[model samples]
Target: MSLPEVRLQIAAVTLAEELSFTRAAERLNITQPGLSKQIAELESRIGFAVFVRDQKRVELTEAGHVFVRGCKDALALLEKAVRTGRATQEEIQPLVTIGHSPYVDPVLVSALLGVHLPLYANLRLRVESMFAQDLVHSVLSAEVDMAIIEEPADSPLLTLVPLVTEPLYVLLSTDHSAAHLASVSFEDFGKVGWMMFPKRANPTLYEKVMEAGKRAGAVPVEVHHYVTPHEVIQLISENFGVAIMFKGIAQQLERNDLVARPLTAAGLQVNIRLVLRADQSSRLVNEFGRAFLKRVIPQGQQAEISGQLLLKL
Candidate 1:
């Protein structure tokens, strides 16, 4: 039997993971109908239905589970082969892909970019910016060697090394009642419109923000979802809303008409971290991580920095 096309294998694997045609297609950058056609062609070539699908949901058939496992292994091996071939070229440096959450502080990104490992002078680093959850997924899928992201849910397959921890800040108009305070309590803005990124951006952080507000006994009169810092800035400056976000984000978008005050609510902090697969075996990638961490936390202060860092979520 002829082997299925590589794209077909990828479509099947992604569909298996997501089980939602809409999402899998989005990940593949293909239309839903196009993805369905690929799966159909793959099944036709293989003489078996890999997925059991209906309008309501999609499920992998008995054989699909085994097939997907093999596909994942094959894809991983193909990736390794490509990397090995590239590294074997006379002048090519080994490439390591690093993903970062868009919300993470620029200093951390700058620090990672500034790392210079003595042992791997020819190492090449590529960085991609994505949402926090997408970074985790990319790491798991081997699309990214490592990622700097906001704290995500605990996963046995991943290790997280905390990089930065700072209290969330409330952004509001200078004329707002709480603008005069050095720090604002959640209660101060409990009755105003609250603006935040949609849950899809970072579900864990989104839920944490909601839970934090509840614990502080402060719920907004209405919550507005925003997709960009500029939008948040616009809304707050126009006195249409207020926001709770990381200090770094607030600082980056600071404006004369706006003011940011540390949010004094407990458990409302943004924790940036370095996340990598627990089973990582690349010496270049591993050493790069060590060198980067050393740059962020100097040798003599490792012990002291450990105490200050939020080591766990």
Candidate 2:
């Protein structure tokens, strides 16, 4: 058996967060001395002091920070395992939540909803909408079993199943100088203006665009942030600025003098992915993921390749 059992790990993690024996013990509904003993046992078993304490204050050791992070992840995984196992044992229709960013294409979302698996006929899906930034946290915390998002931050703990890879498109007024061109570069945006969603909506993609603009010397004359495609349409109609977005979004908003043109900025591609926890162990959830990939593969040959590549990875 492991020396630092779940109880010891919990104690260490709590104490590490609180940095106070009294508070940690109270939170755990244990005596301060009991908490101390558990931490001592953990340190002795692991042969490392996770905390430094004198009379007034407590602090994590250099190694303690790393250990505590691992403890948190381990505890989260254990909790998920218990919940998933209990659901499988008790529920006739085990619910799997699938969250998505509001910006995800409607076609892909429809594809996901259309998937059915003969082996897991009782599996049910609950869909939720969130911004891409929050979707990442929701997936990592197991709030949702998986997420369909665009341009999430890189994490080793996540397995990103790429669903679609396409060039970003820009929505500009028909009267704009670059409107006649089949493709516009970020440099064109520098001369005009740039309108996009706020960074909070999708920090990774927002930063990527900003970085690309910097690399291309395409500094925008003015910057505007918008929340919805309708707002993008309004801004473009007024000749406020050009909005850069995924191809689907641009195409959807192509009307009323708004035109969609591919952005020729290198490395500025839009990547839509189905994100799953790398450590997911539930058979039902894994099967649902496979079913989803299988369902979307029929959309195109590129989609089939994406599905096969996801399986290979």
Candidate 3:
């Protein structure tokens, strides 16, 4: 990472303030060698030496005096800025992270943001989208405070909330013969090329889809891996391969060349659940979840939820 200009200025000011290299190093909590290196780097950047040092004593040069004064002024201004920023930043909502695997629900996210953004004084919400395994790892490591994901089996550390249940749909090209059917089964598409994401993306969902195909007593000769929903859609649209995805996502789509049919063979339900680490505590995430539920879930259904923190959106 690049060193900040403020860092160099702070180092210069710290050295100038203390005068003694040992005292300055102590104040900076860095070794004397580290301090010397820092000063050398700063000097290199400025294209001039700032200090003169012998074995016994250290002194600032004429140019060093001028630079030190400017640095001191800049540091004072920076200190004032830090104080002001802290005051303002305190009003900003605590950073609450919410994680998702692939595309969960854009509509719900938008509505939640719109309805409750102004409700809290310090409730800044950050959304992170990643592969299911990575999301689970994030939650496990406390990198993400909460997550809406399909797989709950990987991390036993999480307190889960069963959110929404939707049927899996088989995406088919409009030109495909099975597209004419209202719904299709894995058995029907057994011989067809299968477009699937890696198991790491979502183990539970991937296993369910694959198991469904196996239960149908047939497997595709070719399996194509895709990275995203749009890629899957693009492949299916071009008659490349077919894929299984949550039906709710398909409802929000307006594709004329691709059709999503309910995959009735596996009876697999896409469980998009909200999960947080059981060992961790996050009032921010809980409050955010409450705000989200208030906008989405009805009052009658709200009381049915056992706990505020674990309740799914």
Candidate 4:
């Protein structure tokens, strides 16, 4: 087979991992039409149809499934040979690149790197910040070694591990009347000015927030949209608008003048997950994951335990 044919096999395996062409295109860093053309060329050479494409979604045929398994094994062997060659020339450190969503706990990243830094001082730990969808795509494509995303992506090529779940909170200026209240309901703040991230950066959260507002009979007055959490909090502190954010974000903010209260009416929680390629069997990845779980999970559980202790006291 030609070099392009081999590359096409890798792309097909990735596409099989994610059933959607749109997502597969994003993972491959190619346009949708380009990906389709490559797939067509590969099929023509192989003389068999690989995907059953309908209007809504695409499904792999039985032959496609078998071919994907073989391709993955071949890719792994080729990668190993390359790594072996590099190791003979120099002591090449194994790198684990991780991607994170804006909502992910920075502490988790810090802790993960901290544990592995001493053990493998030569190893490199790189972190990039992006939206959940992009982070998931990066992990599936092996662009980054792994990712910490807000929610799991619907892909068979990646394995998702639940990290921690945190309650959602509404952040407002301390001077606001609602700031003094222990809790606020959506009904009470229906007409209030609000700040939110743009739909592109946070599609899942944006949709859920809009849906929640509708369910609570609130018509959100968008004072600003597509603002970062740092900017949102700054605006709130200056009394520009109110923002709904995950509780972890509140903990990270150094501004003591801002108040974050539980939104009793919203009743939404955000889940943080660690995503890595299903085929990856790297020791460093597993070590990093374990380190994060060891540090963050206990802290999260302790908060719950402390709350229960206060009730008994």
All candidates: CA RMSD (Å): 6.5, 10.0, 14.4, 7.7
> What's the lDDT of the predicted structure labeled candidate 3?
0.69
Model 2, CA-based lDDT? 0.77
TM-score, every prediction: 0.73, 0.71, 0.64, 0.69
Clash list (residue pairs), candidate 1: none
Q: Is candidate 1 or candidate 4 better by lDDT?
A: 1
The candidate that achieves the highest TM-score relative to the unseen native structure: 1
Worst 10 residues of 1 by lDDT: 304-313
CA lDDT, candidate 4, residue 253: 63
- Candidate 2 vs candidate 4: the TM-score winner is 2
Reference-based lDDT, each prediction: 0.78, 0.77, 0.69, 0.69
Per-residue lDDT of model 1, residues 60-99, tens digit only: 9999999999999998897677556545731356677899
Q: For candidate 3, lDDT tens digit of each residue in 233-295?
A: 766666666886666566555378878788786458777777777655344456666676677
Residue ranges of candidate 2 with Cα displaced over 4 Å: 1-59, 62-82, 119-123, 298-313
Clashes of 2: 0
TM-score of the candidate numbered 1? Answer: 0.73
